[model samples]
Target: MSLVYSTETGRITPEKEQAQRPKGDGIVRIQRETKGRKGKGVCIVTGLDLDDKALKLVAAALKKVCGCGGAVKNGTIEIQGDNRDKIKDYLVKQGHTVKFSGG
Candidate 1:
């Protein structure tokens, strides 16, 4: 497996095969929720390969594009708000096959 990093972003993809897999390929669905203190809400992007460095790159790109604070944990990218379209567009432009889930 080869590790690839996006030139536009500093995010890294550890394995090429895993990154090209169909199981969880693409921009994920995001849901908004106001939980925890001060009712701070967040958007959740799931079905990603957490251990893969490529996914980390994807997460970082999404975060930068949305200009929001987020993280990659539990194999999911959690942004601060709904940014499905932005993430999808960015992924497509980066030349990775993307599959969008949820409404």
Candidate 2:
């Protein structure tokens, strides 16, 4: 076992690493969530089996298509506003199996 504190290094601690997202089941699901962010609705895209860089690229393309500002958090892409239909169309064009998860 390693000591939590070290006299020579002051407070010894491990470096924080980026969270690793689990692999998806091939099917992609898109849902809308507004629990946080003061009631602003965001489309949550999940089940994309892509790495962080690729995920960001996909998110950028989605944002461009929807003409909105959004972000990639964890393994999901959150697009601003209610753009389900537009997102679905784009994903379909990209040859992805997309489905609306929540109502």
Candidate 3:
């Protein structure tokens, strides 16, 4: 169900403003996982501080660098195969603090 706004208050109101989430810290985590795809692998990057458009741009760039496909799902970047080092270096160049997690 959609929210119902009173005619007197209109669409622009303070209630919507309070729902936006604050940007994340500069830290990003790169992890490699392979348990869910019948031996196929993926690198999961989380803790991005940008909005949707920015995140999509970042994902595209990483895909180019890694020479593989990837997607930004639920604010996290999931790249095909293992790319922890490449992603870390790229993020570092972009001025973000990155950390490697998982095997």
Give each model a TM-score: 0.53, 0.81, 0.76
Better TM-score candidate (2, 3): 2
Cα lDDT tens digits for candidate 3, 31-98? 99899789999999988878889999999999999999998887789999987889999999998988
For residues 34-78, what per-residue lDDT tens digits would candidate 1 score against the true structure? 567267667776655446697688778888899988887666777
Runs of candidate 2 with Cα error greater than 4 angstroms are: 1-18
- Predicted structure 1, TM vs. truth: 0.53
Q: Least lDDT summed over 10 consecutive residues: which range in candidate 3?
A: 12-21
lDDT of 1 at 28: 48
Which portions of model 3 show Cα errors greater than 4 Å? 1-23
Supply the global lDDT for candidate 3: 0.87
Candidate ranking under lDDT, highest first, comes to: 2, 3, 1
Q: If both were scored by TM-score, which would come out higher, candidate 1 or candidate 2? A: 2
Off by over 4 Å in 1: 1-27, 92-103
Per-residue lDDT of 33 in model 2: 90
